[model samples]
Target: MVLHTVNCPPSHPALGQCLRLLAPGDALLLLGDGVYAALAGSRAAAELAASGAALHVLDVDARAAGVLERLADGVSVCDDEGFVALTERYPRQQAWY
Candidate 1:
């Protein structure tokens, strides 16, 4: 399985390309400006929800973006430790800037 970390905004091409490549067992972590895509009711949120990959957003980043409560359904919040755990869980990783 692959673990994908997207550090860019939804408007960036990184997220779209990453989404297309995701499989059912993969995981995706949204950080930095990428957290904006997890905002509830957003098109990006809808797309992410349908991606089939386990979805995660960095807790600190979501809090800094003021989107903790507004995060879309099915998206889990992860701390720094959780990030490290994800890296350990998956053998491969793709960083989307």
Candidate 2:
């Protein structure tokens, strides 16, 4: 499955559109302002979890958003190395900035 990265906020329509295209086994990496989606009850968070895609939030971004401690159960927190690994593991990547 292709790996997708969304670094935009929930208010961005692109985030929703991107999530709708994801399927199980796909990956979504939330970075930049997108870490806000990691908030437990946010709509973006719910949609991400419901889609069954592997959800990942950048550690630095999550901390900057002050949501590192409030991320949902299934969201994985990743560092730069992990991000690099994701790029290596997935052949295709779609970035939603």
Per TM-score, the best of the predicted structures is 1
Off by over 4 Å in 2: none
Candidates' RMSD to native: 0.6, 0.7
lDDT of 2 by residue, 7-86 (tens): 88999988988888998999999999999988998887898889999999999989989989799889999999999999
- Candidate 1 accuracy as lDDT: 0.94
Clashes of each: 0, 0
Given candidate 2, what's the lDDT at residue 72?
87
Model 1 residue 43 distance off true place after TM-score fit, in angstroms: 0.5
lDDT of each: 0.94, 0.91
